[model samples]
Every structure is written in structure tokens, then in C-alpha cells.
Target chain A: MTYCVGVSLDAGLVLTSDSRTNAGIDNVSTYSKMYQCETTPDRFLVILSAGNLATTQAVIQQVKRDVHEGKPRNINNMAYLADVADYLGEILVNLIRKHNEQGGFIADATLVLGGQIKGREPNLYMIYPQGNYITSSSETPYLQIGESKYGKPVLDRFITRDASLEDAAICSLISMDSTMKSNASVGPPIEVLIYKRDQFTTPKHYKFDAEDPYLLAIRQEWAHHLNQAFRSMPRLEESQAQPNSYLRAL
Target chain B: MTYCVGVSLDAGLVLTSDSRTNAGIDNVSTYSKMYQCETTPDRFLVILSAGNLATTQAVIQQVKRDVHEGKPRNINNMAYLADVADYLGEILVNLIRKHNEQGGFIADATLVLGGQIKGREPNLYMIYPQGNYITSSSETPYLQIGESKYGKPVLDRFITRDASLEDAAICSLISMDSTMKSNASVGPPIEVLIYKRDQFTTPKHYKFDAEDPYLLAIRQEWAHHLNQAFRSMPRLEESQAQPNSYLRAL
Candidate 1:
């Protein structure tokens, strides 16, 4: 399992992903799930992937190969970010289908594609394995894939279109931290990228290993503050008495 | 979908569940998922259920019917909490099997059984639909069923065997609140029960509707505190410059 989040804010976009992959418990390994593609200086794209490791890696290889070989409709030559997303989706679906047909295997992959083209606004899109995609909206400016629920409450509570890039990045980190704490499959080192709108370049990227000082500090501080928050909330008033009958017959 | 949690603490047990049931998006209904039974003063139990509504309701009906008919091995006749868990698990598996065999349909359910029998200490068990069960431990003092991940981080961070019953109850509420916020399928009204050890009677029970004042207040206060907590955390230092290459070729 994996956990990756992409946030589209008024100021920019933020993407974060965990780096753990496992075919099974005994075969676990650490592999970067975030891929950066800059077809041109003005078009920068980051892809966060989850699900079947082989399928994702194959799709990534195909995309890079297409761009390098200057295919007719490659990521490098796409006119719009949405076109790039569509192209990636097509590549993913074809790869999975080919593998399934050849070996009767069921391989699937899901991706979060987010970044900016020279003339377009920064956008975030979740590409399904079935060769379709959905972009984030103003009301819900974030998209998550793989082991998402554990990290989702924080995003539901805190993410907003107007949030500053730095704030969004921090929120993404916290979300990833929550997921890591709850799931053993989602371990560190964690990768975070903050893309400034219209910059059309690689965003500021930070990677934190499990014992990284800053990461540890964030975890400790968040835990402390959370407990304090809970303790400070008003307690339920003690009921005057136990109800005469606690069971209502069905 | 549903979200129910039971916490075992030194003070006693805290169980909380949401009351939303849905066959599909348009077929949602409100149904109480918490059931209490006190066959005798010495043996009291509360069952929190999740999964196929028909299956859970049928299992509950069967248990009640057996007790009413004075079955040789009904809940009333069980001597240990584990025995009761076993009985409930058997009923669940048998009911599911019978329905599947008769109609070629698959219906499943999971339950959390927590309470006390006169001679034994308070206990908590999660009975799977397959007739297997697992209990909480000192290190992990809580068991959750259905839509569990969204609400699990808080429990992992705060719950402990020594937490007071009130604190455990509060934690369970927060856990439920988190689940409700993240998932549309899990909603209110919320039901909470706090059971004190050594007292076989029904625990203090409170139900909070979506519009309930206290529930609203807790939501507001928790949101406020969470924001404050986030703001108080130390911010990551700004990196001096964008790296020449942010991507390392895989």
C-alpha cells in the first residue's frame, strides 16, 4: 500500500508521497513513488503513483521512453496539462492491458498528476487505472490515492484553495505523517514538493527519513498539541442517573 | 458503511458508533446499531455491529430469540465474555452461510462485543463474520469495525489502558467525529456508552443527533483547537535556493 496527496491551492500546488513498496510482507522495499517530468522548461509535471509496483514502473518507463523518442503525442509535446494527463492515462491503461493479456495477470495502477504548463494554471488530476481522470475543484482542492482515509480527516478540516503554498505543504506533510503512524505499509522517507503557480519549473522538494530531525520534531509537536487540544475540549456533562431501561426492544 | 469503536481501559469500557445505514447513495436510513442485553444483573453486554444491515439485524434477532426461548447455550447461559463472543460469532457465521446457501447471495457482518460477566474482568472482542474473534490488549486497547482508518490515528496517539472512562469516551467520540468528517457513509446521530468495571448494569448512554447542541459545541471547539494547534507548530525552514536537479533518475 501507499499514500500520496496532491493539493491545488490558489498560490500553487503541493504533492507528497511515501516511499514504501511491498509485493508481500517479507518482500518489502523502499522505492520512490514520485516521478518528475519536465518535457520543457515551461512545462513541469510531477506524478505520484500507487498500486501494482511493476505496472507503475512500466508506465513511467514508457512515458520517459516516449518523451525521449519524441513520439507523436508524448508528454514533451503536449499542448495542455489536461492533454498530458490524458496521454499518461492512455499509457497506463495500455500497459496494464498488455500485461494482463500476455500473462493473465491483473495489474493496476493509479496516479496523481499535478503541475503547470507555461500558460495554464497549476492543476491536480487523479488518473484512474481505467484511462480516465478527474481534477480537483475549488471546494475540494486536494486529491489522494492509496491508504487515503487515515490522512483524510486533516485534509478535510484544513485544506483550502486560498491556503498559502507553505501552509499547504505543511498540511500535506502532516497528512502523510498521520498515514504513516496508522499504517505500517506507509513508511518513510517522505517526499514533499511545493510548486509555485505559473513558475513552470520543478518545485521545492524536501525528503525526510524516519529519524530526520525536522520530521521527528513535527511528529512530537503535533502529538503534544493534539492531546492538549483534546484535553481542552469540554467534557460531556455527567448524566444525572443511569436510564431506567438502556435497551429498546427491536 | 459504519464506524464503531470500543476501548478497554482501567476504569472500564467506552464504546461509540455512528447510526447511518445505506444500501446505496439514494437509499440511506438511520438505524441504531448499538444493542444492550442484561440477561441477568451479573452478565451485561453491549453489541456494536457493522456490515450488511440485513445480516446484522438477523444475527441480533436470533440471539434475542434464543435468549427468550431459554436455549441451552444462549448469551444468558454463557459463563465467560469469550464464550459470549464465540456464541455471537457462531450465530453470525451460520446466518450468513444459511442466507448464502438459500439464495446464492453473500451477506457479511462484523461486531464488537464488550462487557462483563460476574467473575471475570471487563473485556472487549471483535467477532469476524467467519466465526473467529480477537480481543484488545494493554498495548492496543481499542477495536474498531467498518470505516476504521480515518478515525484510527487519534486512538493510536491518545488511547491507553490507564485512561479514565471519561477520557476514553471522549477519545472515542473524537475518533467517531474524525470518521464522520472524512466519510459520507458514516454519519450521525452518534451513540456513546461508558461502562464502569465491576458494575454489571447498563453503562451511561448518550445519543447525539447531528443538530444536538453539545455535539455542535464539541465540533466547533475541536475545530478551533486544531487550528490553533497547527498554527503553534514550528514551521519548516525555507530552503536557501531551488536545487539544480530535483529529480534523481530511477
Candidate 2:
């Protein structure tokens, strides 16, 4: 299982992914799942992937090969970010079909394609295993895949298109930390990238290992605040605490 | 889908559940999933259920009928909480088999049983549809059923066998709140019951509707504290934010 999130904010885009991969509990390993595509100076793109590792690696290799061979329809040649998502979705769909047709194993993967393309607005899209895709809307400025639920409450509470780039980056980590706490299938080293819209340059990337002090600090702080907040919840109204009420209900 | 949790602490036990049930989105309805059994004053028992609504309701009805008819193996006749868990598990497995043998649907419902049987310690057990049961330990003092992941991180952070009854109740509500925020399948009016050790009395019961002022206040307070906590995270070191780093990473 995997957990990845892509946030599209007015300031830029924040993308994050967990690195733990397991075939079985005994066969766990670490692999970087974040890849920044080398697009022309006018466009910027990064992909965060989750699902079958073989399928994802194949998709990434095919992407590199297309660019190396200068395939006419490569991501580097796409004029819009949505076009890039479409191209990636095609690669994913074909790979899945090819593997399924072989009948020995299942092949499926989901990817988040997010970035800015020239004069267009920065955006985010989650390409599904079926080759369809969905972009973040004004109502919900983020997208997630894989083991997503544990990390979602925080994102639902804080993420928005109006959020600043730094705030989005921080919120993504909190989301990741919450996930790592709840699910062993998802773990560190956590990789994060912050892409500033329109610049089309290299985004800031930070890799935090399991023992990273910054990650620990933020986790402890959040726990402290949560406990304090829990303590402050309006006390269960005294009237609601009546004893022996069970007898009456029965 | 449903979301229900039970917490056992040195101070007592806390059980909370959401009331929303649905066969489909268009058919959504509210139905209480919490049941407090009629037992002798020396004992107290509560069950929180999730999964196939029909199966759960049937199990509830069976327990009710057994007690009303003075069946030899009814809950009121059990001497140990573990024995009660075993009894409940048998009923669940037999009910499921009886339904599935007819061959039209999957008969499944998982339950969290928590309370005290006089002279025994307070306890919590999650009875599986397959007739197996698991109990909370000192290390992790809570059990959850249904849409559980979104609500687990909070319990993992705050619950312990030594926690106070009030703290456990507050923490359970927070878990319910988080689950409701991330998944539409789970909703309110939320129901919570707090059982103090040895009292064998009616534990307090509170139900909060969608617009309950207390629920609204806690949700708002939690959001405000979370945002503040996000802001206070250690800043991303400027040295890590180098430009054109993408070119080298490729």
C-alpha cells in the first residue's frame, strides 16, 4: 500500500509521497516514488505515484525513453498540463492491459500529475488506473491516492487554493505524519516537493528519514495541541451524564 | 459503512458510535448502532456494531429475545466478560452462517463489546464475524470497527489503559469527529456512553445531532488549534530550498 498527496495552491503546488513498499511483511523495501519530469523551460511537472511498483517503474521508464527518443507525444512536448495527464493515463492503461492479458498477476497504479504549464494556471490531477483523471477544483484544492483516509481529516480541514506554498507544504507533512502513525504499510523516508507556479524552474525538495528531528518535532507539537484541545472540549453537559439511565432505556 | 470505537481505561470504559446507515446514498437513514444489554446490577454491558445493518439488527434482536425469554445462555447469566464475548461471537458466526447458507448475500457484522462483569476487571473485546475475538491490551487500549482508519491516529496518540473516563470519552468523540469529516458513509447524531468501573450503574449517554452546539464548538476549536499548530511547525530551512535543483536530481 502507498499514500501520496498533491496540493494545488495559488502560491504553487505541494506534492508528497511515502517510501515504504511491501510485497509481504517480510519483503518490505524502500523506493523513492517522486519523479520530476524534465520539461522545457516553459513548463514544470512532477509525478507522485502509488500502486504496483513494476507498473509504476515501467511507466517512468517509458516516459524517460519517450523523451530520450523525442517521441512527438512525450510529456516534454505536451502543450498543457492536462495533456500530460492524458499521456500518463494512456501509459498506465496500456501497461495494466498488457499485464492483465498475460494472466499471471494484477497490474494497476495511480499517479498525481501536478505543475504549471507556461501561461496557464498551476493545477493538480489524479490519474486513475482506468486512465480517467480528475483535477483539483476550487472547492477542493488537493488530491490523494493509496492509503489516504488516515491523512485526510487534516487536509480536509486546512488545504485550500488560497493557502500559501509553505503552509501547503507543512500541511502535507502533517497529513503524512498522521498516516505513518496509523498504518504500518506507509512509512518514511518522506519526500516532499514544493513547486512555485509560473517559474518553471526546479522546485524545493526535502527528504525526511524516519528519525528526522523536524518530523518528530512537528508530530510532538501536533499531539500536544491535540491533547490540550481534547481537554478543552465543552464538558459532556452534566445533564447528559445521568446514571442508571440504562435501566429506564431497557 | 459505519464508524464505532470502544476504549477501556483504568478509570472505566467509553463507547461511541455514529448512527448513519445506508444501503445506497439515496437510501440513507439514521439508526442507533449502540445497545446496552439488560443485565443484573452487578454487571454492565454495551455493544457497538458495524457492517451489514440487517445482520447487526438481527444479532441485537436475538440477544434481546434471549434475555426476555430467560434463555439459559443469555448475557445476564454469563459469569465472565470473556465468556460473554465468546457467547456473542457464537451468535454472530451462527447468524452469518444461517444467512450465507441461503446463498444470496454476505452476512457480516463486527462488534465491540465493553463493560464489567462483577468481580472481574473492566474489559473490551472486538468480536469478528468469523467467531474470533480480540481484546485491547495495556499497550493499545482501544478497538475500532467499520470505517476505522480516519479515526485511528487520534486514539493511537491519546488512549491508554490508565486514562481517565472523561479523557477517554473526549478522545472517542474526536475520533468520531475525524472519521465523519473524511468519510460520508459515517455521520451523526453521534451516540456515546461512558461506563465507570464497578458501578454497574447506567453509564452516561449523550447523543449529538448534526447541529448540536457542543459538537460544533469542539469541531471549530479543534480546527483553530490544528491551524495554529501547523503554523508553529519548525520552518523549512532556507538552505534546503536551492534553485534549479531539479536539473541535478534528474
Candidate 3:
């Protein structure tokens, strides 16, 4: 299992993926899940993948092959972020089909793609195992796959288009931290890619490790704050105040 | 679906559960998931359940019947909290078997039980579908079932024996908030029960609707604290500036 999250914000897009992959408790390994596809300053795309490593790698390899063979069948021809998502979905579907034709094993995988194409606004999409995809929008401005629930509450409550890129970056990491605490399936050595809108060609990338001080401090303080917050919740009055007063009023 | 969490703290035990039950979105309804088998003063046992409502109700009814029958299987003869968990588990197994034997539809469910047994310290246990149960301890001080993962991180980081019942209550709600955000299957009209150690009597129970002012405040403030904590993390430069940089050594 893996945890990958991508947030589409007014400033740009924030994408993150953890590197830990494990077939079992004893077989953990590290693999980079962030990939960049660029065809010049006007067109830039980033993909963060989760799920079966074989399926994702195969999909990426096929995409690379298509680009190398460059013609009518290349990702370079995919003019929009949606087009890119569709193209990647096609690659994954074809890879899964071809692999299953050989009768060995097929993998379950998902990919998140977000970036800007020359003339359009930035966009984000999540590509599913069966080659279907959904675009993120203001109503639902984020997408997460694999080990997603633990980190999701904070995102649901706080993330918005008005959010700053700096803040979104921090929010994504906090989400990842919650996931890491509850799930052994997702671990550190995480990749964070931040792309500012219109600055499509370049994005800042950071690799986070387990002992990263800021991560540790956030974990500690969040824990402390939660305890303190709980301590401060008004205690139930000893008198029998109508327990269902609010519900009855409703 | 349901979300239920139990924590064993030095101040006593905290149990919280959401009341939503659904066969599907169209079939959603509210059903109480928290039940107590307290004979008051002499023995106090609260069962917080998540999963099949029918199964939990059957188990509760069975326990009530045992008490109504008296003598051989009453609370007086249960002996300990462990015995109470076993009794509940046996009832669950029997209920499942009877439901299956009659060819009725039955969904799997899990129960979390904890409280004092008059003469001993407060204890917590989680009962599974098969009627087997596991107890909480120093190493594992909490138990959750039915939409557990999303709410698990906070408890993993903060729950301790010395934690106040109030603190446990808050943390569990925060966990529920996370689960509720990630999974539509769990939702509001939440129930919270607190057991103070050695009190051996009726525990305090609170019901919170979606708009409970205290809940709203914590949710808002928690979101702020999480974002602030994330922003407060030092940048990579400061993280890397240490002369004893462990990451560089790695």
C-alpha cells in the first residue's frame, strides 16, 4: 500500500507521494513515485502514483515509449491536463491488458496528474485502475489515493482555493503525518512537488525523511494541542440539564 | 456503518460512538450504539458497538435476558470485566449462528467493552465477529472498530494511562471527525460515554449533534492548530544546517 495526495489550489498544485512499498512486513523497499513530463516552458505535467509498483512502472514505461516514438501517439500531443490524464489512463489500461495476456499477475494502481498546459488554467486529475479519471475542482479541490483516510479530515476542514501554496504544502505534509502514524503501509522518504500557477515549467521538490525536525515538532505539538484542547472542553454540568435539548430544538 | 472508539486512561475510560447506521445511502437511520450492563455500584460494564445493528442489539438483549433470568448467569456471577467480554462474545457468536441457521441476512459487527468490575481496575476489550475478544494494555491502551483507521492516529500518539477521561473523550471525537470526513458511511448524532475508575456505577453519557457548539469550536481550532503547526516547521535549510546533520551522515 502507498499514500499519495494532490491538492489543486488557486496558487497552483501540491502533490506528495510516499516511497515505501511493501509486499509484507519484512519486504519493504523504496521507490520514487513522482514523475515529470515536459514538452517546453508552455507545457508541464507531474504525476504522483500509488498502488501496485509493477502496474505504475509499466504505465510510465509505456508513456515513455510513446514519447520516444513521438508522432500522433505521444503524450506531447496531449494538449490539456485532461488529455494527459486520459493518455496516462490509456497507458495503464494497455499495460494491464498486455500483462494479463501473458498470464502472470496484474497490479492495481492509480495516478494523480496535475499541471498547466499553455493556454488553459491549471488542473488536477486522479486516474483510476480501470482507466477512468475525475478532475478536481473548487467543490472538491483535492484527491488522495491509498492510505488516505487518516489525513483527510484536516484537508476536508481547511483546504480551499484561497489557501496559499506555502500553506497547502504544509497541509499536505500534516495529512501525510497523520497517515504515517496510523498506517505502517505508508512511511517516510516522501516526495513533495509544488508547482506555482503559470510557472508551469518548474516546480520545487522536497524529499522528507522520518527524523525531519519540523515533521517531528508538528507531531509533538499537534498531540499536545489536542490534549490541551480536550482538557478545555466545557465539562458536563452535574445537574440534569436536558441531555437532548439541542436535538429536541432541532 | 459506524465509528466507535474506546480509550483506557489513568482518569478512567472514555468511549465514543457515532449513531448512524445504513444499509446504503437511501436506507440511513439513527440507532443507539452504546449500551450499559451496569448492575450499578457492584459492576459497571459499557458496550460500545459498531457494525451490524441487528447483531449488537441481539447481543445486548441476550445480556439483558441473562440478568433478568438471574443467579447462574447474572452480573453477580460474571466475576470480572474479562468475563463480561467473554459473555458478550459468546452471545454474539450464538446470535450469528442463530441468524445464519435461520437463513436470515446477517452482517458482521464488532464490539468494544470497558469499565470496572467493582474490585479491580478499569479495563477495555474489543470483541470481534467470531466472538473472540482482545484486551487493552500498557502497550496497546485503546481499541476501535468500524471505521477505525481515520481516527486511529491521534490515539496512537496521545492516549496514555494518565490521560483524563475528558481528554480521551476529546481525542476520540477528533478521531471520529477524521473518520466522518473520509467515509460517508459514518456520521453525526454522536454518543459519548465516560467511566471514572472505581466508581463502579452509572457513567456519564453525552450526545452531540452535528452542530454542537463545543464540537464546532474544537473542529475549527484543531484545523487552525494543525495548519499553524505545519507552517511552524523549519525549512530544509534550517533542518540541514546542523553540524551533526544525521541526514547528511545517512
Candidate 4:
């Protein structure tokens, strides 16, 4: 199980991934799921993967090996963010095909690649196990893969295109906190990477442990605030009930 | 699809269920997933169902019919909350078996039963498709079935046995709101039932629609507070960066 979230905001793009992988509860291991491909100073890419570790590692290896051997493939040439997404999908499919030819080791591994080249705006994409992918647009503005449900509500309630990079980062962390609480398979030492728009040279990254003071404080405060919020909300009582047919059905 | 959450607080029990059923995106309908069985002053049992509408309805019908006929069953003699849960599970299994024996039907509905008997404190149990169930305790004071993830974070962050009834009710609503945002299958027209401790005769029931002014305000206020909270948190700067071995590997 993994929890990885990438948000594309007006200021920049924010990416966060957890490092806990478990074949079973007893077989837990720490494995970093975020990979960066920065062959040039101007072009940058971040890949957050979830599902079968072997399949994702194999796919990453294949792409790196291709880039290593200087193979003049379609993805090797200069392309925009969308082209990079397509190339990543094609590479995943080809890798899966190669693995299948040799008795596939992993049947399920999906990847999410998001970043920008020097010329265009930042973008985010979620790739399926079938090697198909979809990019986030203005309306969506965010993409999350792996154990997404626990964290989705916060994103839906808070995230917007005009949101600041700092706010996006906080939302991703809050989202990760949600996943970590409900799910045992996902644990801490989370990796958060941020890239300012048009600045492809360096990306901001942070690794948060479970005991981080601020993180712990935020979780506790959020819980307290939530209870307070609920109590403050007006409670509908039986006395206020009007003689309505719908109220009778309740 | 449905989203139902039941919490056991020191004050009493809180249960909320959405009223949306969909075979697919096109074939969506409105159906109540909550069932109440009370011998009045003796026992108060509420069952929330999720999964295939037909299967859930059949299970509920079988249980209700058995009670109506005054059968000499497990629940007939023992009018307790735990006995009620057992009776409900048995009816579910019998209905599933009968349906399966007649023809192949997917009987994969889950039930969350919570209430207080005359002799015991409030108890919450999650009934599985196999008719087996797990009870909620101090450590796990809440039980949720069907589309449970989106709403899980709020519960994990806020729910506690010491929480007041008002707080529990608010938590349940917030959890439902989260589920509805992430999953279109579980939508509004929410049903909330609050059972105060030792007050089995009087249960507070409220139905909230998507356009409910208070609910809308809660959602809006929550979103606003979240953004404000995130902005107040400090951002990590490049100078504060320590050694990140994970990034070194990349």
C-alpha cells in the first residue's frame, strides 16, 4: 500500500509520497517511491509509483537504461510535459510487455508522473496499470494515486487552482496524515517535493517522520478543532421539526 | 454504493448513512440503508447496510419478517443489543444462503449495528458478508461500512469514547461529507441518528440534504479554516534543509 499525492497549483507543483511498502504486514520494508529524472537543468520530472514494487522498479530501470545507452527513442528527444507523460506511459507498457514475455513478476503497478519542461507550464498525470494515463486540467488541478480515498475529502474541500504553493503543500501533508491514520500499510518518513513554476533547476523536498513536532501538533489541533467545529454547528431538534412528510420518513 | 458510520461515545451512539444506490452511473436511485429494531424500553438496535441494494433489502426483509411473525428465534427470548446484532447477522446469512441456493447472486452487503440494551452499555458491531462480526471497543470506538475510506480520516482524527453526543453527531456528518465528496456513488440526503446514553426511548434523527444551509456552512467553514490553518504553518526553506539520503539516491 502507498499514498502519493501531486498537486498542480498556480504557484507551482507539489508532490508527496510515503516510503512504506508491505507484501504483508509482517513483511514490511521501507522503499522510496518517488524518483526524479533530470537529465538537463531545464527539464525535470518526478514519478510517484504505487502497487507491485518489482513492476515499478523494472519500469524505472528500463527507462533509465534506455536513457543511459543513449538510445534515440521517441521519449529521448525534446518534448513538452504532455509528451513526457505519453512517453512514460509507452515506456511502462513496453517494460510490462518485456516482463510478460519472460513470465511477469508483477501484475499490478501504476505510476504518476508530473512536472514541467523549460518552456511550458507544470502538469500532473496519473498512469494506470494498463499503461494509459490522464493529465490533470484546470478543473481538477490535482492527481492522487494509491490509497486515495482516505485523503480525498481534504483535497476536495480545500484545494483550488489559485491555491498557494504553501497551502498545497499543507493539503498534501494533511492528506498523507489521513491515509497514514486509517491504513496500516502506509507509514511515515514521507517525501514531499515542490517545484516553483518555470524553475526546473531545483525542486524543494522534505522528509517528515511521524514524531515531527509541527506535524504532531497539526494532527492534534485538527482533531480538537474538528470536535469544536462540530459542537458549534446547529443541531436540529425534535421540537424544531415541522409537520412535513419527508421528516416523517426519517 | 453507500457510506454509513457508527460511533460509540461516552454519551451514546451516533450513526449516519447516505441514501444513494447505483447499479452504474446511469442507473442511480434513492434508497434508505438504515433499519431500526427496538422492543422499545428493552433494546434499541439500528442496522446500516451497504452494497448491492437487492441483497441488502432481502436481508432486511427477512429479519423484519421474522420479528413480525413472532418466531421463537435467538432474538425472541433475548431482547438485548448483542442479541439483536446476532439475530441480524443470522438473518443475513440465511437470506444469502437461500438466494445463493436458488440462483447465483452476489450477496456482499455489510452491516453496522450499534445500540444500548437494558443491561449493557452501548455496543457497536460491524457485520460482514459472511455473517461474522467485530465489536467496537475503547480503542476502536467507531465502526463504518460501505464507502468507508473517504470519511475515515475525520473519524481517526476526532472520534473518541469520551466525546460528547453533540460532538459525535458533528463528526458523523463531517465524515459523511468527506465520503460524498470523494465518491459520487454516496451522495446527499443524509440520515443521522443519535442515541443518547441510557436514553433508548428517545433517539434524535435528522435528514440533511446537499443544499441544507447549515451543512453548506459547515463545509464552507471547514474549507476556510483548513486554508487558514495551512497558511499559518511555517514553510521549509532551502537553508533549513538537512541531508536527505533519499534525494541523494535519486
Compare the candidates by lDDT and give the number of the best one. Answer: 1
Model 1 / residue A128 / CA error / Å: 0.5
True-structure Cα RMSD, model 1: 1.4
Expressed as tens digits, the lDDT of each residue in A162-216 for candidate 3 is: 8887677777887888888888889888777777888865577777788877668
Question: What is the fnat value (0 to 1) for candidate 4?
Answer: 0.30
lDDT of 2 by residue, B1-250 (tens): 8999998888889999999999989999888898888778889999999988888888888888888999999899888899889998998998999889897677799999998988999999999999899999999899999999999988989888888888788788888989999899999988889888888876888888999887788788877877777777777786755354562233
Candidate 4 per-residue C-alpha lDDT over B106-143 given as tens digits, one digit per residue, 9 for 90 to 100: 56778998878787888899988788888998988999
Give the per-residue lDDT of model 1 (tens digit) for B1-250: 9999999988889889999999989999999899897577888799999999999998889888998988898888788999999999999999999999998988999999999999889999999999999999999999999999999999999899999888888788888888888899999989888889998775788888999877887888889988987887668776622364456565
Which candidate leads in TM-score? Answer: 1
Location of the lowest summed lDDT over 10 successive residues in candidate 2 chain B: B241-250
Tens-digit lDDT track of model 3 for B9-104: 878888888988997789999887877664646777778888777878877777777777774876557778888888778888888888888976
Candidate 4, residues A158-241: lDDT per residue as tens digits? 789999787788788888888888999998888888888988767777877778765676677666665555556666566532
lDDT of 1 by residue, A143-178 (tens): 999999999999998899999887887788889999
**Number of the top candidate by DockQ?**
1
Per prediction, the TM-score for chain B is: 0.96, 0.95, 0.90, 0.92
TM-score of each: 0.97, 0.95, 0.88, 0.91
Looking at candidate 2, what is the lDDT of residue A209? Answer: 88
Ranking by DockQ: 1, 2, 4, 3
DockQ of the two-chain complex in candidate 2:
0.56
The segments of candidate 2 whose C-alpha lies over 4 angstroms from its true place after superposition are A242-244, A247-250, B242-244, B247-250
